[model samples]
Target: MSATTTYNGNDTFHGWAASAKGAPLVLQEMTLKQWTEDDVEIKISHCGMCGSDDHYLCESWGPSTYPCVVGHEIVGTVTRVGKNVKYVKVGDRAGVGAQSGACQRCENCLTGNPNTCSDLKGFILTYGSRWPCGTPSYGGYADKWRGDQHFVFKVPDNMTNEIAATFFCAGITTYAPLKRTDVKAHSVVGVMGIGGLGHYGVLWAKAMGAKVIGMSHSDKKRDVALELGCDDYIVTSDKEDRKRYFKKMTHILCTGTSPDFQWEPYFDLLKVNGHFINVSLPKWDFPPFHTYDILKNQVFIHGSAIGSPNEIREMLKFAAEKNVRPWIQKYSMKDVNKAMENFRAGKPRFRFVLEN
Candidate 1:
């Protein structure tokens, strides 16, 4: 039986949202908008609360438009599909990530880098952004969503909706950088955080056959990190222990959002010609580093966002093949507010998925 055939929107759906600035999320009734020829209406079954969602809703990053539906990690079955959509058909299990739409004709779009498109003015975010038609783009906090089919991905049959939802964003964010750095077998990898993204890094890197090391400030996540496939766990809070592990890593992926991190210690962790990649967006000035830090070791520092469609596809296939399932906590879509609060409190075991 096709997955989509099971969806029946008979009951009124409740979605939780922050109605305004500095206010708690309110549960409200939402109606799915009319669909377009290139649109696929998904009856949302699960949504993951992301850090970006928290940033936007709390206006920590910027002022979020009121009534914003803040969620990006979405998974559901296609309730309807437009005639133009061949990649996804009605009744297909699918998902949408951080990006909802981008101009398909821009050079970046044509080159498979739509995420970095310069002239792509109408890039519709999954939430907190207006669509080209001026309708506010509600997210997976709702019962159903109508989105352009190009941005939707067919969930692998082997993956559960709860797991597939988190992969839409958090999985791709870490996977993109790993692939860009050519992480491979025998690579000595260091992941610098134990939160949502970092956990995925440990799983993905190990799956890629890397000798993975999980780096964190404390030993609290040590057991979990090792269980997630890290070859070792490094507690950076102990300066002596950190120094002991210095110069032993080939690539260090910094997933921590803490702004007060001591860069020199991490720089010392790199092997010659190693790369330090940052995926977390933290508010802080880049600290001064002696030229010798780079000159002596030939190290490079860079940043990466979510992956392109092709990259996401590759990561998803890799995940399925390796059984790199994320550790996630599931909640009902109606409990979006509570879920977001728990996420803010860092209360999830790792990641949180809201079921519809």
Candidate 2:
């Protein structure tokens, strides 16, 4: 390991960071950890805003270690690659997701599940986390990012940076859960919450040959869901709509979260033994339910983390081949505060991407 790091001393990387919890990000200079042969440096071109980013900014997921620079759906050009790096090289366009590093020796990591690495420090997040060298891990809301190359991926030439950025987080989050299930032409897949993650779930499920149904509490996203390839749309708040789709889905991918979220009706929407896979990370714990419902329905209720490195690579390839592009609203990286404001207001039609 070299004592020489990429952004050192006077050669600091600049980013918009939150000085305190819930504070708007301000431009600031930051340093990188000690450089290793497995690291790669990226000059960021685009980054997608995620709900998880907000959770960190507001400290809803617990008190965030500030000054936090959070934007995990990252895409950029590789500016430098350490000697041991091989997945990508300098000048190649690359992208990173919520994960930056994990202990390679962990059972989960060795089994190709680094996204859920078992070691205490193995699940190194791109932001709101710390590196082994005691440096606070910053994310892609910056001019550059330097970290373990294993978590970084080369962008497909068929996709633009803005489009590629969304897949790293929102895309992978939904895709991984759905891929775990056997969704095919005969399957009826329900995508709950037609927002950032749900939109991708709809897209991926449809591409996987399933009859996709877009579900939301209200009808606001109905037309957009149809445009995103959903075969049908259901407003779950409507009793008639709920009755109409009773026991209809082979699996339900819950991608949205609200403090007042209702879960019982969605459980009824699932077929016997259907999967109710939730990938949303809400600040509030789910309201309690009766075990009778679970026993009677014989359904599976589980949660999924972000995808492993191999899963991410597989998703990117599948997305590119299927032309699975996200509906993104772009903002200049300098207007990050404005973007955050809009995000808080739920303004993104699907996803928001920041350009450098």
Candidate 3:
């Protein structure tokens, strides 16, 4: 295989950026670097707008680098691949998620936990971070992107590119915890929140043969949940009705970050020895409960980050096998600012994907 030469042109690509603190995202033109031997250049086809993207671009989480291009849930075609890249070939459809690179030789990497690699200092996030060579790591909001082969995954031939874009982040975020839990065939599983991550949780749990229940604040989504294969729908705001459904769930997955949420209601919903898993990044006080609740029921609470690459691959395979698909709205790449605004406003029907 011949090595690919460097690309050196003033290729104009449109991407949205937050050039300063507390400012709205603005569309900008950037010069893309030439492709290297270890690089795969993708002409981004679709990029999912995640909550994290909004958090980063608006500097909500913390101070962010200026000129940061922040979309991470990326699906695109490998327009060019470096000679050393064997995992992806030119023209192959691929996706990139929250992560872009890690130290592959660390203990964490060798053990399929590269996401937790300790020696890598700061993890190379897909956007607003410096690459190993010191160039900024841009994301998939633009017309194209160049990155190492390790961070990219080939989109299964059977999956639509729009859905594949979501699998890059939302799909894997929920799939990781579900795979690690005790919920299985005939188990009662409750998914709180009907947005991106919560929807995937309901779908995957149902596909895994669990009796899945969709829990939300409004009854309007009840029909949508059932249509998405949920066996039951619980409106959490109806106190008496919600109580009636409590104590039936063997497992509860909380995808919302309501710090003021009455935690006792959710705990009451769990059966003896039930487990509650949290995947949402919410600011909340710890639940105030007695030791009796823990001892009598053996209930447990836990949290999970996004999955490892191996886990992501398995989740994609599972999604393909189960015919799981996310409800998404597509926006043109040029309208990235509008997409970010909509995501911040929670305007997508479910998830938003930016298509080039």
lDDT of each: 0.81, 0.88, 0.80
Residue-wise C-alpha lDDT for candidate 1, range 1-356, written one tens digit per residue: 43234435422345676788757777787644435678788888999877777778767766788777778898998987766888898889999998888888888889998766566456778887677766778887777778788789999999989999989898999999888888999799999988888889888888888999989877888888888888888887778877767798988998874666767888889998898998886545557888877888889888887778888888889999998999998887666777777888877768999887
Error of 2 at 347 (Å): 1.0
lDDT of 3 by residue, 138-198 (tens): 8887778887788789999998888899988888988888888866896899999888888
Ranking by lDDT: 2, 1, 3
Candidate 3 clashing pairs?
A: 7-34, 247-269
**lDDT of candidate 1 at residue 300, scale 0 to 100:** 88
List CA RMSD, all candidates: 4.0, 1.7, 2.7
- Model 3 off-target regions past 4 Å? 1-13, 31-36, 120-122, 283-292
lDDT tens string, model 2, 1-356? 34364434233689999999888799998887667788899999999999999988888878888788999999999987878999999899999999999998988889999999888776789997788988989999999999999999999999998889999999999888888877778889988788889889998998899999988877788887898899998886788887888998889998885678767887898889999999988889988888888889898997999999989999999998988888999999999999999998878988989999
TM-score of each: 0.92, 0.96, 0.90
Output the worst ten-in-a-row residue range by lDDT, candidate 2.
1-10
Q: In model 1, what is the error at residue 325, expressed in angstroms? A: 0.6
